[model samples]
Target: MKTQVVIIGAGPAGLLLGQLLYRAGIDNIILERQSGDYVLGRIRAGVLEQVTMDLLHQAGVDTRAHDEGLPHEGIELLFKDARHRIDLHGLTGGKQVTVYGQTEVTRDLMAARAAEGLTTIYTAAPVSLHDFDTAKPTVRYQKDGATHEIACDFIAGCDGYHGISRASVPGDALHLYEKVYPFGWLGVLADVPPVSHELIYANTSRGFALCSMRSEHRSRYYLQVASDQKVENWSDESFWNELRLRLDPEACERLVTGPSLEKSIAPLRSFVAEPMRFGSLFLAGDAAHIVPPTGAKGLNLATADVGFLSRALEIHYREGSQSALDRYSELCLRRVWKAERFSWWFTSLMHRFPENGEFGQKIQEAELDYLVNSRAASTSLAENYVGLPLESF
Candidate 1:
């Protein structure tokens, strides 16, 4: 089969990119190694930066997001037995984040693709890229135990961190930077009203905790745990008890607890692969970078990467120009590095580091104190949290 673009992932990045391309009269197909059900089943963060919401609207998939997604004007930072609210909307020129789940975003994109008859091949396994460095690029994969090949003008490697896209790049040609944190987040999703209207990020002598939500009725909470901690060791009661100990007295009073709908421990890490583009193959989303979830930048970064990638491809096909494509990596990395710095900084401020010792903890406390007390520092945090402006291609 032959197409203008072959996308090697059906995650939000690939699906959203496909929607954008299809609307532009560009031919593209998405290949996924997993079933659609499996993709939807994965739980993820819900906070959406303004740029992400804008792109979703651009793709004609924001009806549900705007209608159902909660708009948070601020986030609460808890420390020293008190809660400090950072007014994100007030600080960022009336910009606010929407609490829309990544799962819902994927669902919306998938539905749009199906409604428009766009092609997405689920269960396409053993995918491989060939000759991406040359003028002609091809994608090979296995479908129902049968090998198939697709010749394409361009390949979007949106297949994510563990997918074949990034791994296929020759080691000598790729430069990698990574830092794994000493802790993990033990997260729980429950069917209950959220503890607060807006998200709360807390730093306690015990550890770090975050109170977030998918909606008014579905709450998502996380507690920092040892990286080697086993989920099986913490029962629902124990999780709730530990969470309460870290929260402020008022929050703990109003906090609701219930049987967890889902529970898991995810290790924290910051990873970035320099030069997101490799010839005709361009990596987007987790294939190119990853951020600690403290700042909720993972999905947002992926959204931005594809927004740039889609526009670049659109200009190439419509105006017969390669200017945007040529500048894709440079433009993307500028934003990527900024996000990496923010996530790293935010994580260090909120989480406990055994190696940091007492002096490190004191420094973290001082930084938080300054961030909440200083208007400039608060504004800086708000701007980064809501996301910086997108670069026009």
Candidate 2:
């Protein structure tokens, strides 16, 4: 097979990148190692910052996203069994977040692609690259245990955190930066409704617990846990009991239990591969950078990356130039680092320190108190949560 662009992974970054290029009158191929059904069922982030929503609208795929998704004006910070709401619009002037699952967005994009007649080769694993030094670059893959080749003008390595594309690139040419936090998240997708109108990020001595969503009838919640903690070790009874203690209190009715849909543990870390482009290959999303889920910024960051890369692809194919292509890395990193900082700050703020003395806990409490009361602090959180502008490549 041959095309102008080839995308790997079929996650948000890869699928959306393919759609944008298709709209630009450029043909592309997406090779994924997983089935479409599996991709759709994977539980992940749902909060969409205003900036990401705008890009989806611009890409013409936001029709269903706008209709089916819920619009949230702000988030609530609950601590010491008390609730405090931050009016994001009031704080940031006009920005608001939309509550839409990652899986839903992927399903919408995949459906739109089908309507527009874009084909993806699912269960296709890349074998190797043929050329990047010539006028055409190529990707060779094995699909259904058979070998195949895709000739392309460039490659978008959208395969996520543990994928091979980022590692296959030469180490000398790549600069790797990483931060591994002391904690991980025990994320649960339960058949329970959210306990509050807005997401509540609470910091208790128990650890950091974020009350979020997968849908109205379903709630996605997470609690900080030991990095080695396994989901199988956490029983249904224990999970509910923990939820009741840390999340449910006398101020609010206890969280109602629903069937446990899924549970998994993911490490919290920040990583970025500098200069996201090498030859005809470029990295986006988790393959390029990862932020702790505390701030709910990973999906938003990937959407932003594809937004920039798709525009650059448009220019490269339209103007017949390499200038824009050469700058992909520098451009995406600007926003990537900013998000990393925010995610780290949020994680540090909500998680307790093993070395904390009485003063450290007091300081954290003071900070949380200020975040709810101070306009400047709240606005900073609102601006980052609602979204930051995408950089142009």
Candidate 3:
């Protein structure tokens, strides 16, 4: 089979890219190692930056998002047993974030692709990229006890951190930078109303806790735990009890507990691979970088990457120029590093670091005091939180 581009993975990044290119009249095929149900089953962060929402609109898949996604104008920061609100909308010129699950975004993209009769081959395993360094690139995969090869002009590596797209490149050609945090986030999804209308980020003596949601009636909460923490160690009652201890008295009084629909512990890490482009192969989303969920940048960063990639490809096809394609990494890395810094800074400020001891706690408290009181500092936080504007291609 032959197509203009071959996209690996059927996650939001891959699916969104396919939709964008398809709208541009670019022929692309998406290959996924897992079934469609498996992709939607993976629970992820729900906070959507305005830039991500704009990209969904550009891809023409924001109908359900606009109808069901909850928009928040601010977030509360808890410290010293008190809560302070950061006016995200006011501080950032009326910019706001939407609480929409990543799964729902993927589902919307998948539905649009199906309606348009786009090609997405699920359960296409053991995929490999060939000749990406040359003018012609090809992707091969195994399905139904047979090997199929797709010849394409370019390949998109959206298969995530462990997929074959990045692995296909020579190790020496890619420079990897990574920092594994000392703790992980024990997250729970429950069908209960959130304590607060807006999200609350808490930094308490116990640990860091986040009260987020997928919708008005569904809550997603997290607690910082040791890196080696096991999900099975904490029961539903214990999780709720521990969460209440970390919250302010008012929040505790309003908190509602219920059976957890999903529970997992995810380690935090900041990782980036320099030069997102390798000849005709390009990496987007988790394949290119990862940020701790502290700032809710993972999915947003992916959306930005593909937005850049799709524009570059469109320019290549329409104007017959390679300038945008050549500069893809430079443009993406600039924004990626900024987000990485914010995630790292936010994580450091909120989590209890035994290594940092009392000094760290005092410093964090002082910074929180300044961040909530100083307009300049608050504006900076709001600007970054809403997402830095995408650079022009």
Candidate 4:
């Protein structure tokens, strides 16, 4: 089959890109290594920065989100038994974040694609890319035990970090920057009211804990754990007990415990693959960069990456100009690096490193103290958290 573009992976990045392209009258096909059920079943963050919400609206998937998603003007940082709220909206000139799950975003995009009859192949096995460096690119994958080939003008590697998109690039063509933290986040999703109306990020003597929610009745919480920690080792009761210890007294008193619906451990890491474009092939979202979840930048970053990519491709097709297409990598990397810096800094500030010992702990406390007290520091945090303007570099 022949198409204008071939997208690898049906995750948010790939799916969002397909929707954008379809709306622009551009023909594209998506190849997923897993079924639609598997993609929707994966649990992910709910925080939506301003730009992400705008992109969702642009893609015609914001109706449900606007009606049901909770908006928070600020986030609270709990340290030294005190809660300090950073006024994100006030600090960022009226920008705020929405508590809308990534799963919901993907589902909405999928529904739109289905209604429009856009082509997407689920459970496409052994997907591979070829001739990306040439004018004509091709994608091959197995479907129902049969091999199929698709020739396209360009290839979008939106699969993910471990997907073939990044791996297909030769070593000399890609420069990787990465940092894997010594700890991981053990997250639990439960059917209970959240501890607070706004999200709380706590830095306590026990560890780092974040109290977030998917809705009024569904809570998602995370605690810092050893990099090798096993989820099987902690029961629902034990997870709640540990979480309570890290929270302030009021939050502990207000917390409602319930059975966990999902539990998992995710390692913290920041990674960026340079030169997001190679010939006719382009890398977007996690395929090009990954930010630690501390700043809740992963999904938002992906949205921005694909937004830039779609615009670039749109310009190429509509205006017959390759300027935007050629500048895609440079523009995306500029924003990617800023997000990586914020995520790394936020992770380091909130989490306790074993090697840092008491000295590092004291410094972290000092940093948090300064952040909450200084207008400049808090504004910086608020701006980055709500998201820097998509086009601002």
Candidate 5:
């Protein structure tokens, strides 16, 4: 098969790029290894930055999101049994964060794609990159045990970490920067509704706990755990007990415990690939970088990258010039770094570090207290969480 552009992976980045190209009347094909159901079901980041919401609104997919999504003015911080609420709206001149899961975003994107009746290949595992450096890049894949070849003018390697496209680039051709944290997060979803009206990020001597929810009836939460933790080790009682410790007395008991719907421990990581391009093949989203879930910035990062690159591709096609395409890597790296720094700041502030020196821990706590009470400090966070850097636009 042939196309003007072949996007690898049907996740947010690839899917959004495809939709954008569709709107621009540029034909493209997306090949995803996972089934559509799995892709749409995998629970991930929920916080949608202001810029992300703007993109969705402009794309005509925000109607359902706006109707069902949870709009949060700001987040609460819990420490030493005291709660501090930061007014994100007041700080950032009305910027807000939307609590819509990554899975929901994928669900919306899938529905949008199906409604459009565009052709896409799911369960197509990419095996190799063919002629990636040439004008025409080919993706060799096996779908249903049958080998197939997809050729295109340019390939958007939106496939995530552990994807073939990232590895296909020779080691010497790319510079990899990686930071793996000492601990991971044990995320849980309960059928019971959230105990509080706002999200609470708590730092406790035991560990860190995050309080989030999907809807009025479903609560999503997390606990800090060992990086090598196995799901079988954490029981319902322990999960609730940890939640009890991190939460304040006022809201802790009201946190009605319910059946655990989802459970997994994701390792904390901060990674960025420099110059996310190799000839005509460019990396996007997780393929190019990863921000810890601390700031709920992963999906936003992908949306920002695809939004920028998609427009760049449109310009290249309309003007028959490659300047935008040539600058794609640099363009994406700027936002990627901004998100990376913010995620790091949020995580470092809220999560307990076992190896932290006494002064380091005190500094973090002091900074958190100041930020929560000071409009200037909260505004700094509000701006970053609202979206990637505005200067990029």
Candidate 6:
């Protein structure tokens, strides 16, 4: 089989890229190692930036999102037993975020692809890329006891961190930078009204806690725990009890507890692989970088990456110029680094670090005080939180 572009993985990044390319009249095929149900089963963050929303509109999958997604103009921060509100809309001149689950986004993209009769092969395993360094690149995969080869002009590596896309790069060619944090987030999804109308981020003596929701009734909450923490050890009652201790009195009173629909513990880490382009193979989303989720930038970053990539590919096909394609890495890295800094800073400010001791606690408090009171500092936070603009090619 031959196509213009072969996209690996059927996650949001891969599916969204396929949709954009299809609209641009580019022939592309998506290969996924898992079934469609498995992809939607994986729970992820929901916060969506304006830029992401606009991209969805461009892809023609914004109908459901616009009808069901909840919009928030501000977030409340808890410190010193007091709750402070950051007007994200006001601080950023009417910019706001929407609470929409990543799963829903993937579902919308997948449905759009199916309606258009796009080519997406699921359960295509043992995939490999060859000759990416030269002009002609080909992808090989095994399915139904048979090996299939796809000759393509380019390959997109959206299979995520552990996938073969990044692994295919020679160690010497890829510069990897990573920092594993000392704590992890124990998250729970329950079908109950949220603790508040808007999300609340708490910095307390116990630990850091965030109260977020996918909709008005589906609440997603998180608590900072030791890196070695086990999900099986915490019962539903215990989890709620612990969460109450970390919240302010008012929030605790308003909090509603219920059976958890899903529970998991994920370690925090910041990782980036430099120069996202490896010859004809390009990496987007988790294949390129990862942020701790403190700033809710994980999915947003992936959207930005593919947005730039799709535009670059469009220019390459339409204008017959390689300038945008060559500049893809440079443009993506500039924004990727800024998001890394923001996630790192937000994680450091909210979590309790035993290694930092009392000094760290005092310093965090001082900074929180300044951040809430000073308009300049709050504006900076709002700007980064809403997300930095995509650079023009």
lDDT of 3 by residue, 138-255 (tens): 9999999999999999999999999998889899999999999999999999999999999999998889999999988999999999998899999999999999999999999999
Tens-place lDDT per residue, model 6, 1-393, is 999999999999999999999999999999999999999999999899998998999999989999999988999999998999999999999999999999999999999999999999999999999999987999999999899999999999999999889899988999999999999999999999999999999998889999999999899999999998999999999999999999999999999999999999999999999989989999999999999999999999999999999999999999999999999999988999999999999999999999888889999999999999999999999999998888899
What lDDT tens digits, residue by residue, belong to model 5 across residues 260-342? Answer: 98888889999998889898888999998999998888988888888887888888899998988888888889878888999
The regions of model 5 sitting more than 4 angstroms off are 357-359, 389-393
Give the per-residue lDDT of model 4 (tens digit) for 1-393: 999999998998898999988888899999999999999999999899988889888888899999999999999999988999999999999999999889998999999999999999999999989999999999999999999999999999999999999999999988999899988999999999999999999998788999999999999999999998899999999999999999999999999999999999999889999999999999999988989999999998899989998999899999999999998999898999999999999999999887888888889999999999999999999999999987832
Q: Least lDDT summed over 10 consecutive residues: which range in candidate 3?
A: 354-363
Give the range of the ten consecutive residues with the poorest summed lDDT in model 4: 384-393
List TM-scores for all candidates, in order.
0.99, 0.96, 0.99, 0.99, 0.96, 0.99
Flag regions of model 6 displaced more than 4 Å: none
Question: Cα deviation of 106 in candidate 6 (Å)?
Answer: 0.3
Candidate 2: tens digits of C-alpha lDDT, residues 1-393: 889888888988898888888888989988888899989988888899877888788668898778878888888877777778889888888778889999989998898788887879888865576566466888898976788888888888898987877877878988889999877888888887887768888888777788888667888888888887888999877776676767647424757776678888888998888878878888899998999888889999998888888888899889987787778788888899999999889888888676786677678889999999898999898888888877655
Q: What is the Å distance of residue 224 in model 6 from its true position? A: 0.3
Which candidate leads the pack in lDDT? 3
Q: How many clashes (backbone N, Cα, C below 3 Å) per candidate?
A: 0, 0, 0, 0, 0, 0
lDDT of 1 by residue, 51-86 (tens): 999999999999999999999999999988789999
Error of 1 at 234 (Å): 0.9
Clashes of 3: 0
Clashing residue pairs found in predicted model 5? none
